[model samples]
Target: MVHLSHKFSTIPINFIPKQFSKHLPQQIPSQTTPPFIPFSQRQNQRSLLESQLISALNCCTSLTQIQQIHARILRKGFEQCCYVLTKLIRILTKMEIPMDSYAKLVFNQVENPNPFLCTALIRGYCLQGHVKESVFVYSEMRKKNVLPISFTFSALFKACGVVNDVDLGRQIHGQTILIGGFGFGFDLFVKNSLIEMYVKLGFLGCGRKVFDELPGRDLISWTELIVGYVKAGDMESAGELFSELPKKDMVAWTAMVTGYAQNAKPREALEFFERMLNEGVETDKVTLVGVISACAQLGAAKYVNWIRDTVENLGFSPTRCVVVGSALIHMYSKCGSVEDAYKAFKVMEEKNVFSYSSMIAGFAMHGYAYAALELFHEMVKIGIKPNKVTFIGVLTACSHSRMVEQGRQIFESMEEKFGISPGVDHYSCMVDLLGRAGCLEEALNLAETMPLEPNGGVWGALLGACRTYSNPDIAQIAANHLFELEPNAIGNYILLSNIYASAGQWNDVLMVRKMMRERGLRKNPGCSWLETKKGVIQEFFSGDMSHPRYGEMKQVLEDLLNRLKAIGYQPNMNSIAYDVSDEEERRILITHSEKLALAFGLLDINADFPIRIMKNIRMCEDCHSFLCAVSQITRRVIIVRDNLRFHHFHDGKCSCGNFW
Candidate 1:
């Protein structure tokens, strides 16, 4: 008898009708004398074999196992069964096997392929990022007079979204409208997939147009457009859609919360989270992460215990959820408790790259350089790959601590040892490290000669270093680049003017002021936030005594100034960037937002607890010195987080060792 395998390849299976005899063998072996089973028994045995083959395909965990099952299908003469073949194609896609290597071959062997079978192959190609191949497959299906299913369009649109092929997406989108039956068959799944595609491709207007045209919109459709608005930085549009959404689910609620958190609107995030809770929407790990991230940005100690408790109450342990643990580590660190951040890091049963990076970043941000480096070494020992973010944390630790040599070695070893090429961010860290170490010339050299095109961060780092060392010449060069790169960034102009003023270059300072005026740029008023013992947040702006306790705060500031002056703390007159009298400069320096926050903190914060202040701008030299003296005089630890890094003052010294 002819080999059974060869016979199976030519047999007409379930998908192929008997009239489609071109794929069938020309002759069949007849068994006249053999004792044969009944026709019902033979059919039953074939069905049983088909069921067993499908079950085996489902249980297959490896490519080799799948190949064995495919061989078994051929032996059973069921290779062309559309149902079984579709399942095989889906399994191959799930296993991430390349469609070209196996699925395509299986599809080509089938005769009179069904719509579902063709769509499965198209979906397989789409899953493997072969969009062109999927489109080709669609064309072939159309040529074969096979009507595409709903999932076919969904898969194609999703592929378009993945590759950001908006042009092809538009083509497919147009087909959905032009093709009569297919357009009517375009259900919620296809519509939502189209919305997601347009949104992800940065075509929010198109996405909205699709949303408006949909006969009925679901939660996914609304959420996709809302998230698109948020990503485009148009929160107002996002809010309008969000308000218009009738039935909200947890995913929709989480999108709003996450949008606010990502846009740096922490208060709005918390408010949305509260609203989500009040509406009785269920909370998941994603929702909690959004809330936790907002709390981290706030850096308020009062929210720390509450958020931690909420996470535990929801049965999402920081120790169990690495994301929660990472967010907690960041929260505690920003809240001025590096110890608590470490505790969270220690209890994490499963530590990934994120956990290690967050903990190290927390240590670095808190100026715990030794701790950051130790953790980094431990991460390497445990074989977790150090990504760009991890290296950023390591370099930040070195920069803040003035570990110039150590930082340099690591910077050099980035591409060579760790296989992580230094990005613009890493170069920014180097500029900061060298600049902080008083290596102005070297930092400037590195900034000018680096392989990558420097971004705002690189120029900003150089400008910051210039401010630290009072190098007006280098600051001007950095400022010129910054002015072109970030014309509207008032901080860059302010920093440049400050550097010039520090060197008593009044003419240059006036020129900077003129440029600011010509560009219609106004100085960003410095603001500081302080959380009181009663958990009420108070804000202080430079030279603004608008607080309800302004009178008491003024008196407190005056007393502290007197006490600070008595201890030989003279105001650094150069801190004022304006061309003014020395005495007037002293008057202006004392009214800075940080000083105002410090006074209010001393007044309201309890004696046992450390005072925490958050500032919108970097503290001036005079304020830094003033806080050091105040910390020594009051015998209290003061933690101040500025625009850049944290300053922990205790007994007349800062945790940064005065390098920052």
Candidate 2:
């Protein structure tokens, strides 16, 4: 609601004479001019003076300076000159000065304002968020029969978009058609602006209509629509349009890459990026960011190395590019390499909130709570404001490390000290922290009494904690709400079922399973990824022993199991949620996706390399214990990144200390 014009009110206004005095000659010649200077010479002198005044206006840094220039223009007998006045208005607009306060007064003095001058005023008002005032100016211009130029319509459309006034935008669109004779109706620039407006207002259909009607569309026209579809989460439509675009530019290609990346289609994003590179399309930091995001989502060490090499070959150093560095930090973290993430963070010459947050979250993901908290404090000490995501990382660190009091104090400080109100996500983090710390009642009470309504994440966190702590009572309460809020979220049902199974409540487990069956919801199959020594990423699924190296993989698991059992490592059968016999449970535990991935890693990956596995679900207690025992028996480091967080096992201990 703050007006830009109000900020300049303190400057004193000096009134200049609107016309020459009656006592003086109607026209004053230049200094030392002959008594009867020729008319052509006088005209030349005026043109030169206009150019000089315009140049001065262009260099003006303040409204007072522009006002002084205006006085000079009036004294030089160019008061009605639209050329200089239009330039003056544009300068004032660029300075963000209020249009009505000074520009309107100067415009009123002009006997016949030109189209460009009016357009400048219109754009200035629009830019200052005065859409109605700009529209009024447009109406008055029409009343005077001042046919709007293409720029005028473009400015209006842009303004309407800013204010989200679709009705006004359509009215202006009608004006373009009604006043079509001036050739402004079919102006390419105006059409593109219209498309941009519709897209910004979430009127993609209207934008497409404008695009379809274009007599001759250019790259900007196509790019605008492509980006519009991308924003709408319609990547299929965006791809179809992109495929039809005869002349693909980097902007259009990047739109597709970024669109796929944002829509969680990372593989498609990378494929498109690869195609773009093959086609020799130029890449900038923006394109690199999309590719980096895609790689981060894949969370494969192979892609990590590929991206790092690609960036190096392209001469894009992380130390110089904050965007690339921040993304690398996240990618490294997700790929189970917090050490590499920290290295990337340390080498960055410039760090923003994103870079700091990514690094903190990376540390938190690896269960390096002290390191995450220390970096957060460093970020704050250096004057970088922590956003909600940063606090999420901080709270997650506390949640994982059981730092309850610190988490509580920081959650309280979020609103009181930082002025950031606790949103539902923050509340969820608090619930997670308290629940993970075994205060199930307190976590439930907090979720119920939160100022904002508790969302699925809040209840889901409590449910997950219930599974961890074997609390079926609290699990049922959280699951009931989750069932209503996210009816199709199979994970909630699975968690509730697991909690029941762990508590020996077979009836309740069966009931939850029946609910899932009735709703036709199936649990997501567990999948895991591991990169081999040759840098090929391999995928495995739970209970699927169809690998070409199935014999070797099974033999490796058997050998490790035998070695683990010698040291008193027994399988945690409670991990299974179904009603199965002991033999079936043992078979199911041995065929887990992560266990298979670990076996594959041992068989193919170099001995010196840490066995890194990425899973699509939480690691079960049995698998977790097996990995710990394997790491100790073999004296090898095994890192597993699950949906929740990273677990680095070495010397018979996990980074999470079995707290997870």
Q: RMSD in angstroms, all models?
A: 5.7, 5.7
TM-score of 1: 0.86
Query: Could you tell me the lDDT of residue 332 within candidate 2?
Result: 88
Give the runs in model 1 whose Cα sits over 4 Å from its true position. Answer: 1-49, 75-82, 108-118, 139-146, 184-186, 412-418, 440-452, 562-588, 658-660
- Candidate 2: misplaced stretches above 4 Å? 1-50, 63-93, 96-118, 125-147, 152-185, 198-206, 232-236, 383-389, 408-427, 439-455, 469-481, 503-507, 555-590, 617-635, 657-660
The candidate 2 region of ten consecutive residues with least summed lDDT is: 16-25
lDDT of 1 by residue, 1-660 (tens): 234356335533443333322323334435477567899997886676667667778777887667666765785567789988898999999999999888888888887789899999999899889999999999998898888777889899989989989999999987777674656434788889888899999998998888998888888899999999989888788989999999988888899999999898889999999898888889998889889988887877777788899899878999989988888888888877889999999999999999999999999998888889999999889899889999999999999989999999889988999888899999999999999999999998999999999999999988988987888999999999999999999888877887888899988888988887788886678888989898877888997867788788788877878998887888776566545787777667777998888888888888799989988777778889989998998998899998788999999998877755
Clashing pairs in 2: none
Per-residue alpha-carbon lDDT of model 2 for 227-333, expressed as tens digits?
A: 99999999999999999999999999999999999887888999999999999999988888899988887777778888899987788899888988998999888
Q: Estimated TM-score per prediction?
A: 0.86, 0.81
Each model's C-alpha lDDT? Answer: 0.85, 0.86
